[model samples]
Target: MAEHNTSEERADDMQTQQAIAVEGLTKIYGTGESRVAALAGVSFAIDAGEWVAIVGPSGSGKSTLLNLLGLLDRPTAGRYALAGRDVAGLRGAELARTRGELIGFVFQSFNLLPRETARTNVELPLVYAGVPGAERRRRALEALDRVGLADRAGHRPPQLSGGQQQRVAIARALVGRPTMLLADEPTGNLDSATGADILDLFAELNAGGVTLVVVTHDSTVAARAGRVIEIRDGRSYERDTVRATPAQVAAPRQLQGVLS
Candidate 1:
């Protein structure tokens, strides 16, 4: 009986693990008449290396879920775990450390420091993580090179074009080598061509085993993900998974030369 119980416990523990997992997650604001439920109850699990997209119209609670997933805000109820560790109630330095260590962020605005060079901006996360100066610079440059922005290392945000600035932001996000990458409307500010290039880059990264969670209203962006989750009225519903054609299956290798 004792051995059987131990085996059952192990099996249950194994089932809860993933890159991201949430059960009955809810976030509420205000009280009574003014109360609003940003997320009523969302439960989902994203496996490691899976590319998932969250899509919804405005005010659908997608943004609220993103904030919760990124650990910028706590849920009012239920559970959230990243890499199988519960994080629904993390706060203060613990929260900051977990977020910094496990997640990378890319934004639509290309949030870079106007006065700082590309390499400097890319090194910011490592600095906050207490990496030494010499190692930080090397890692930052490597990340920029991965995104095809190595030659622009000395350029400031204002000095670069929009696509270039966004690349720099991607490099910055990659510098820390976080367990997951969270992007919010990453292509919102770019032209169609440029945005397509970025999307291809994201696909390549996902192919290379990076876990991605993107929140967007753009159908094109949502289509790029392997799985889509729709948020409506603070609830979540899983859409059909995107099946890849033969050519699409072979496309990741070809994506390497896209930015080049």
Candidate 2:
């Protein structure tokens, strides 16, 4: 009985150490009758290395939830724990430091400097993290290589194709070696083929033990995750596990098909 009790306690401790923990997270805008509750009592857990897709309709609190999780916005009530640390109350430099070390961000706009080369753009995160110059270049080049953009390292954003530019953005995200990635509409600006390529890269990264939380309303994009999390009025709804049916399966293919 004592051994069994010890095992149970260990399991509970493991859960507490998850990559993310959201509890009763609430965010409100305005005051009085005009007050808009962006998030209600949203709560969920994301384990390290899990690829979780969050899908919801417009005004469904998707962006609001992401902002909270990313530490970019504050919660009016409740708590958030990232890597087991309570960050709900952190502000200013403390919050900025935590955001730098623990989280990576990717946006749909391919937020790269048009004037900077792919390699230079990928180095920006390291610069913020205060890594040494030589080490920064090494890591940036490694990241670019990982995303198959090494050949285009010297090319500016305008010179690279849209797909390549997105890849550069992804490399920038990874260059920080962050614990989890928060992508908001990562493929929103790309064509179908290009978007598919970006998804493939995400799969490859997730397979290699990078945690992913993607905010997308696109059904096809959401379907690629092992689990789908929907946020409505700031509450999380883990609707169902998503998988490709036998009819939907294709021949063994590249990174894009791995999740499916």
Question: Tens digit of lDDT per residue, candidate 2, span 1-260?
Answer: 33666876756555543788766778998999999988887767778788899887788788788888888888898767787777856888888889889888886577799999999999998887789999999999999988778899999999988778878888898899887899888777677876787789889878887889999877778888877887765566777522321111221122112112
In model 1, what is the error at residue 51, expressed in angstroms? 0.7
Candidate 2 local Cα displacement, residue 210, angstroms: 1.6
lDDT of 1 at 168: 88
| Candidate 2 clashing pairs, residues 3+ apart or interchain | none
Instruction: Identify the candidate with maximal lDDT.
Output: 1
Q: What TM-score does model 1 achieve against the real structure?
A: 0.79
65, model 1: CA deviation in Å?
A: 1.0
Q: What is the lDDT of residue 59 in candidate 2?
A: 89
After superposing candidate 1 on the true structure, give the runs of residues whose Cα lies further than 4 Å from its correct spot: 1-17, 30-34, 241-260
25-106, model 1: which lDDT tens digit per residue?
A: 8999999999999998887777778999998788889878988888877889877778777775577888888988989988
The total number of steric clashes, by the backbone 3 Å criterion, in model 2 comes to 0
